[model samples]
Target: MPAFTDIMSDAFDYFRAYALRALCKARAMPRGRIKHLQLVVGRIYNLLKKEAAYAPNTQQLQDFRAAQQLEAALDRRRDDGSAPERGFAAARPGAEREAR
Candidate 1:
């Protein structure tokens, strides 16, 4: 069997490739859709943050950091006007009601 570190490295590499592909696809999507994708990534990052807090393992921490970076990138994209005009609130449910 492969060593643990080797397996982890391979998995991380695969994850990077998959994320890149998804990002490329997202670039072609409409601004509203990108906002939704950003929201989804943000949620994933938050979940990873919680998980890392509970487990406190190296791998978990690394994954949490990666998610955090991705979330930041998405936020930057949104802020730069590449995502939406109405801002993040537009992507959340009941945002219109909340805004009123």
Candidate 2:
């Protein structure tokens, strides 16, 4: 099973992408305004991380540091073509038929 944090991260990322798509396609928002909204949302998300970062025991501290390092490494690897590109990707045309 995935960790709760992993699930929540996926959920938030999906929602962010959905919102951006809606803003671009339906609302025709400007890119500058979209970027500003992303920044603000990111700042608010960081507050949640901050609130959970205090009072960690030695083991928890180690795990937290390791997770941070792993995330950074994965992000750096993102440009190496190891990660699949997801932008604008969508389900196949026949997916609905398959589901039915």
Candidate 3:
């Protein structure tokens, strides 16, 4: 299987989009929503990766490996779909996930 980073990032994108839609509705946006979003995405990715890697080998692990492999293969496509804002410039704490 491929590195965990690709797999986690793709999964995060799917869930993050859904979450953004649900929480984005408001005349005045909640404070730090974007930052909070980033943290949630990171946490989900780490949790999934940990569950897949640390647990004993099993059918679930096999499934995880396959999904991660597919994610790596489609990384370019996935990244293009999830490109960050053009004008957003800042090294936010915990914004970037650690490479596995």
Best by TM-score: 1
Residue-level lDDT of model 1, residues 1-100, one tens digit each, is 8886553444444444545555555566566756567556545544544554344456755775676577678667866976345645566777788778
What is each predicted model's overall lDDT from 0 to 1? 0.58, 0.44, 0.45
Residue lDDT tens for model 3, 28-53: 23334333544444444445545544
**RMSD (CA, angstroms), candidate 2:** 14.9
Clashing pairs in 3: none
Locate the minimum summed-lDDT window of 10 residues in model 1.
7-16
lDDT of 2 by residue, 10-78 (tens): 434544453444334323333443334444444433433443344323453454445445434543554
Over 4 Å off, model 2:
1-54, 86-100
Ranking by TM-score: 1, 2, 3
TM-score of 2: 0.29
Clashing pairs in 1: none
Question: Could you tell me the TM-score of candidate 1?
Answer: 0.39
Clashing pairs in 2: none
Score every model by TM-score. 0.39, 0.29, 0.26
